[model samples]
Target: MMMNKEQEKLPLPLLFRQEANESLLAFCRESARDLPWRRSVTPYRVWISEIMLQQTRAEVVRRYYDRFLAELPTPRALAEASDDRLAKLWEGLGYYRRASLMKRAACVIVEKHGGELPRDYASLRALPGFGDYTAAAVASFAYGLRAAAVDGNLLRVLARLFRVEENVLSSKTAKTLREIAYRMLPDAKDGTSGGERYLYDGYAAAEWNQAMMELGAQICLPNTQPKCEKCPLSAYCIACAEGCAERLPIRESTLKRKEEARTVLRVTDGERYLLHRRAEKGLLAGLFEFPNKEGTLSEDEAKKAVEEMGFSVKSLRALAPARHVFTHLTWHLSGYEVTVPPIDRAALPEDFFAPTKEELYRDYSIPGAFGAYKP
Candidate 1:
């Protein structure tokens, strides 16, 4: 295969190749945080943790990981979980689609792979919610397979170590970095065996990818202020040697985040709060949320809107404004608390119902976007 011109210009590192791996592993051995997933490394735990960690901070995931596993301890449990149950379990973790796709993937695992995640990269990648990074992560960490999981952190580490100047977000750069990372694998030697058992030191391959990822997350960092002075690979990093460690792995985001105004309505009876199920497909698909409209509405306007939806707004008052930022949009929300006399349950819309706050917490899966208006 012909190499990209950019990759050719900035050749992969050769000096201290083994030494760098040693440094990373040594540092990780002493300093790797005792994460819940690491404590009990299994294909199921690795898959869940990788999926949760996507676009989310590690600290935030720590609290939810244990709870999720305790509730749905196996693929069969996850496969058979009701949408509301799954959503409730995944509450407060944004990106409801991850939970949904995981449910689908769990069903696939139970049906096709006998309720255990496939140990290979291709089968793992074929499952819903399992992308290249996630698949490689589970394969390497769980199964001890020699697969390279190149995430943003790993990309930063590699780009700095080799002084790569290409945009890290570009597909070509990603492919090149994956190639570099795969070459750096501890098990890498000769021919590719299309199954388990590649060709290197047997035990170290499991730690290689995790060590790289941990180094990036803890020390390599991103932006212009990575902790290079404390980095294990600093001695081998071209970016550090050339005094440009901070400027490496150049990236530029092309898309702008659109701003939107929303009025979240909290229609409640004396005991139960009204909730609406979002459409089956789209953002926050199949999740329950408070009744809401497109633009921020005034107290009178919001109450009028709620009344039009087959309810008599006995009392209406505006609550504090809140903001929720998504990948491509920011929702500047205006919320109102509306109280109504008890209405007949049969009069409500099919997609709308009133669940007590406790019931909402235990049964319905409200998205985090409506956090400010939570009853």
Candidate 2:
């Protein structure tokens, strides 16, 4: 908790979190961002929304959030679900590890905490996928405990408001931000619960956290491109006066993806396409996909593989080539949507799969953002 001479010299009133909270709340009540998760607040619901929002847009999150809730229903249901099922649920949502770790977290609640999400900050932080932002979000939003949820949105807001220039990727940024937030807390103020002080002021905490995040996501925005005209806190924001809001939340750099060539096999038997469920662990794990090999395969080899699978390749035609980038790898993809004469029904391998045209829409979750789906 030691602050350097420079940090200690900063005026204490400048660190007031409640003032920032009030500014944001005033903005939100007058112009709250409409989101589904905002409707009902629960530990589990808020936790899922937090995970889905990581590196994903609010619109895209809205789609996944509803589907995920409908399918899993509860923590116990998610905990017991197979990795394949979980991965399938999270299909097309990159960063599959988030889904995996979330399932692991649910399992821990069942085994260690008797199916209840522990309310303590430390306990939530120890969960498999919980980072500081996520941990703080769960604490504030769900439990009503005052904490800072410093995601990208919050970081941008803080950086612009404070005019901080530190690289946000650095751990130093996280530490400084958290320290600032700590100074801002309302000193454990007493509040009513059913006309009595049951204390642990959660309602105020929830409003405070949500308002900060909402302001950041909608108004403060990345750099100076912020919609200053529509912003409610324009009068108070430091970046607004300086006109350097966009330049505030500086980041280090994004890792370069290694380019890899892949040939996706689009083997088909006239009406249905061949597919398989990939193995668990490593890239697109458990999502259904056509057989593929790194780099282009010789037509002879591709023909041989198809024949071995008990299908006669009638013709091979090239579809539009596509590309999909992941954190570590870039798939420079080429697909050959081949037509195969119907193979013997019983001869198909156990893991081998075929999807009717309608089934493509039903069964598998292809990453369409990456490339066009072909059968």
Best by lDDT: 1
Candidate 1 on 1-375: residue-level lDDT in tens?
113456446554475446677777777776777788888778998889999999888999999999999989999999998998888888877898899899999999999999999977889989998878988888877887777788888888899988999888888888888888876776443222222331122545567777787898889888788898888888888898998888888986777999999999999887899889889987888888899999978888898899899888899877899999988899999998899989667788899878777987778777889988897
Q: How many residue pairs clash in each candidate?
A: 0, 5
Whole-model lDDT per candidate: 0.82, 0.73
Q: What does candidate 2's lDDT look like per residue over 1-375, in tens digits?
A: 223467655555363445554555566676766788877778899999999989888888888888899888788988998876776678766777788899999999889988888988889999899998888888887887767677778777777767778887788886877666545544345222223221123466666567667777777777457987777667667777898886778888557779998877788878887877777666766667787767876677677667776777898876677888777778887767768987454667876778786887666665543336455
Model 1 spans with C-alpha error above 4 angstroms:
1-12, 188-201
TM-score list, all predictions: 0.90, 0.85
Model 2: lDDT equals: 0.73
- Among all windows of ten consecutive residues in candidate 2, which has the lowest summed lDDT? 190-199
Residue 325 error, candidate 1, Å: 1.7
Alpha carbon lDDT of residue 132, candidate 2?
83
